[model samples]
Target: MDVVKPKNQRSKRALEKRAPKLIENPKTAMFVRGGHISQIVTDVMTDLCKLKRPNAVLYRKKNATRPFEDPTTIEFFSQKSDASLFMYGSHNKKRPHNIVFGRMFDHHLLDMIELGVEQYKPMSSFTSIKSSVGIKPCLIFSGDSFETEPNYAKLKNLLIDFFHGSDVERVDLSSLETVITFTVSDGKIFMRVYHIALKKSGTRTPRVELEEMGPSLDLVLRRTHIASSELFKLATRRPKALKPKKEKNISKDPFGSKLARIHMTRQDMKQLKTRRVKGLKRKRDTAQEEGEGTESSPKRQN
Candidate 1:
């Protein structure tokens, strides 16, 4: 038997199956901690400023000491500023030349990853800067095994989130005019920013040509994304069961380990008490006898 679904029901199901897209209607506010910003971190900040419209982006520098250690305070400030994303950079002997990227979840600072940059090339270093302002560069993510590789899939989603655009596409042989492409190969992700041009053919549309742009850096991602559902479950999880505690025995000495109890009788207690009293009386009597002898000798001398 064949059954036909109603139009409204079909439309509802179609909408249910579609993934929800987060649009940047209110420009995402960002917070940066006050510190010495490295060249790599500065270029990344510049790239983000370009990506996020100038008027829409809001940022502030805060003097923070080890901001990553306390996420709750950061979340407090983030919520106060109505910010959804924040970035901070730090350099020290233990951890040198690293930048942290974090996003808020429900006004709470959520996942964060610190990437250590090995090398950096700033955009100003380039002599021929053809990339004009307000030309929304097309970002492309390309990997043959992205569909099957879990890490690749996650990395792709992260890239899409950081870039914040619905127009970003996956690269293919047909993809000709991609401005930036992130290609994963041999467990390494390579980033390429280019300027593309179209050359007209005899009777067909122009073929695409790519020119390398400046300020390229490598990124190594660490896998640490916790699923929202899993985090929720952890938050609502029950306390662990407490183990039964061992009872203390009164007969044994609490200060001694594996010591046997020595029982004393009433006679032993009485003997100790008598000995203490006798010792005190003997000392008093001796002092009195010496005082009497000294008084008798003093009268004869006078």
Candidate 2:
């Protein structure tokens, strides 16, 4: 006979059921050029946080670089722990440079739930990914020495096209005095505008300065959309209707054998007519000769 297991042993086994598993969080970083700092920072917060509006703390650095550095004149940082930030290196003596732009996620919390940072993070947390204003932002440069209007327009169009979405309303362009503005609908989102004046003469590119302005992210997104109705109308307006190709009768000669055939038909008709006339003439001559021969023979017999 087999011995029965103890109740305490069974209870212990039940209590020892496997513990739920936990996941590890992810870490990532991104570096953006100085010229692109404002744009990238806006994208990251909007894409990561899903916030209607987000803000960052801006700080100007002094004596941060090497020798001969000026006070409060080295670099600047726009920081938001929940959102990504941008860092630009500014120097009075040297060229200002854009250093880095990046974001850090709460990896530990996300990993414990076995989820990716994307799953736990909202889009608004990312700077560049924020919802666009209904109206598109325009870029402008000011200079009396050089005409950069054409280049600026082309760059503006490219940027608009690059950042535009299906929901955007319209894009407006304008310039007044020294300051340029891109007025967006429902303005509340943090947008940094950077301006740079170049030290070199006859240079189209400018030195850099950064500032934040804008409406809410939703409005920004609406401004970015390219209306489908307008696009459809444009497509239909200038249709390129293809010309219908003539089906070649390869059964006949390409050089027009029809014309040659017509000439041959005319020649055949003439030949047939001539033959008929000649036969009629020959029959009449034979009849006349026979009549004359018979009359002459009767006369001789008589």
Candidate 3:
């Protein structure tokens, strides 16, 4: 994409929004429906756009894109919109109800993983209660596959990046009204979203419960375009300014928890100064009279 010179302040602000950052902003996703999208896939995209709102852009018109065949098409869209993440939905005989989840780095495709939706339930299926738009979702991933299988692990990371929302210093419990759960089992991924219901429990903290809020999906793993380890490392590398500087006596373990070492010279117990107590002080000896008195000394009358 060519860098367009800004003609006005509005255009300059637009360019600044797309510029790189040390503390990157929340990832914005562009929702695109393919030429042959099904109603189920379209609804899924719509519900997802609702959740990603304010930061997301939904292209109402269907577009022609085969990411596996011509990746440049999606790459072009990504560049034009200045969005790093995207969801593309399409359907066909072979891969019915197909959806692609992808992310870009430096305006280039970093990763794209496709999943075929086997079963889907739209938001309309659920009741009236639903989460507000653009709330950061609490992501929960279950099953061992997400950790053991390479592809599943990558997909887990991609989903997290797409839905985690913007970063914040502290989150109010009341603001936590949405959850997205992903479970891996039997070579399939089950996805669910819930709205947290806070009811009075007769206590300071309210009782929390989950109400099924729609867009439930059962998906089967399909094609994937994952960047190599080196490329991925480069794309995910943190800015030097954001990284913690190595301190002289402090270090972090694999878990990122800090550990510190103290340096001190050896001490001589005898010479070391410590709190003094009368009990611990040495007693001084007084010299005795050279000769002992034979008789009791006469008491002087006062």
What TM-score, over all chains together, does every model reach?
0.54, 0.18, 0.83
**Which model is ahead, 2 or 3, in terms of TM-score?**
3
Candidate 1 contains a number of clashing pairs equal to: 0
Q: Write the per-residue lDDT of candidate 3 for residues 1-302, one digit (tens) a residue.
A: 99679999998998888788899888889998898999889989998898899889899898887888887988898899888999999999989999999999988899999999999889889894898877889999999999999999999999999987899999988899888899998999999999999999999988989999977999999999999999999998999899987689988999999999999999899898989776666554111221234234665799
Relative to the unseen true structure, what is the C-alpha lDDT of residue 148 in candidate 3, on a scale of 0 to 100? 90
Highest lDDT model number: 3
Error of 3 at 281 (Å): 12
Off by over 4 Å in 3: 1-8, 251-260, 264-302
Candidate RMSDs in Å, in order, are 25.6, 23.3, 5.6
Question: What is the alpha-carbon RMSD of candidate 3 to the true structure?
Answer: 5.6
Writing each residue's lDDT as its tens digit, candidate 1 over 84-149 gives 666666665566666666666666755666656555666556554456544455778887856787
Worst 10 residues of 1 by lDDT: 18-27
Model 3 lDDT, residue 187, Cα: 91
Task: Give the candidate order by descending TM-score.
Answer: 3, 1, 2
State how far residue 290 of model 2 sits from its true place (Å).
83
Cα displacement (Å) at residue 295, model 3: 33
lDDT of 3: 0.89
